[model samples]
Target: MSGRLSMCTICPGENEQIDAVIKIGRERRSVIYGTVIDENRDPVADAVVKLLQVCDNGRIIPLTHTFTDKYGQFLLGPLCPNQKYMLKIYKDNITIRYDPIDAECSDGDCIGNKCKRHDSGCK
Candidate 1:
C-alpha cells in the first residue's frame, strides 16, 4: 500500500482535510508485440492480428485481436505466462498463422514481449 497527504498540519487547508488511501499490488501480466510487413518489408497498415490459445485437447480458442497501425505495429497482452499462444495476421485477403509461441520466460514473474520485430514504430 502507498499514498500521500497533500498538506502539512501547519497548512490552513489541513484542518478540514479529507482522507485518501492507496493500495498497490503486483499485477502479473505480459504482452505480445509484433509488426506486419510484406515480402519487401513494407508496413501493412490496418492489418488484422489475432491471438489464439490452444488447449491440451487440441481445441483452439480465440483470445483477442488488434490491428496494425500505419507503421504495421500491433500489441496484445497482459496474458498468462504459463499459456501458449499463436499469432494470426490478415491483410490483402490473406491470412498467415504463426507457430505457437510460448509465453513463458526465464523469470517466474515474467512479463513483456518475447517476440519482437524491428521497424520504425518499434523504436
Candidate 2:
C-alpha cells in the first residue's frame, strides 16, 4: 500500500502556536460631539441646532439635527468619513453660532488578537 502524509491546517502539529488574522470591514460612520457655547464662551443649555458639513468650495451640506443637553453637550450621529463640519446654532429667531471643525471615522474596531497594548499607545 502507498500513502501520502500531510499536516492539518487548523492544528500546527501540536508543537508550535499559530496566529490567525480575520479582516473586518468597518462601517464608515462617526459621531460629532462637543460642548455648546455662546459668544461669551459660556455653556449654553437647551440650544436647538443643526450640524452642517462644509465643503472646500464654500458649500454647506445639512448633516443632522439635534439639541444641546443640560450640560451644553450635543451629539450628532453617523457622519461620513473625511468631512468638515460646522454647527449652526440658532437663538432669538436667527443663526447665532457657528463652529467649524474637521472630522473622521474611527480607523478600526478594538477587538480580538490585535488588542495587545504596548507603550506605543495601542492598548
Candidate 3:
C-alpha cells in the first residue's frame, strides 16, 4: 500500500504538491500458539491470553489478545519477528506472565523450543 499528500498550508493561493512515496514492504511475521493448563495439567477454557511487546524503556505495549478454546488452546499471530514479546495469561483470578517469548521461530509453535516453561501454570 502507498499514499500521497498535497496541501497549501503556508499560502492560500499557492498549492504545493509534495511527492511522498510510502513504500510498505512485506515484513515477515510469525504466530505464537500454545495451550493453557492449570496446576493439575488440565485445560483451562476461556482464559484470557494477551501478547505484549517489551520495549527497551521497560514499557509494555499490548499487541493482541485472545481467549482459550475449550481445549485450552490459544493462538496470537501476525507478529513482527524482529520485536520482543511476552505472554500474559489470566485465569481463575490469577495472572501468569511468561517473558522473552521467541516469535521468530520457523513454525511459531510454542509447544517446542519457542516457549519456555515458567513456574506459573502454562503448557
lDDT of each: 0.75, 0.72, 0.77
| Residue 87, candidate 2: C-alpha displacement in angstroms | 1.2
Instruction: Name the regions of candidate 1 deviating beyond 4 angstroms.
Output: 1-24, 93-123
Question: How do the predictions measure up, each by TM-score?
Answer: 0.54, 0.45, 0.52
- Superposed Cα deviation of residue 34, candidate 2 (Å): 1.1
Q: Write the per-residue lDDT of candidate 1 for residues 35-83, one digit (tens) a residue.
A: 8899999999999899999888888999989999999999887678788
Task: Report lDDT (Cα) of residue 52, candidate 2.
Answer: 89
Ranking by TM-score: 1, 3, 2
Q: Highest lDDT, which number?
A: 3
State the lDDT of candidate 2 residue by residue for 1-123, as single tens digits: 022223344757667877876454555677777887877988888887898889999999887788888888887777778889888886554676889967653445366645434354433
* C-alpha lDDT of candidate 2 relative to the true structure: 0.72
Cα deviation in Å at residue 112, candidate 1?
Answer: 38
By TM-score, how accurate is candidate 3?
Answer: 0.52
- Show the colliding residue pairs in model 1: 30-78
Worst 10 contiguous positions by lDDT, candidate 3: 1-10
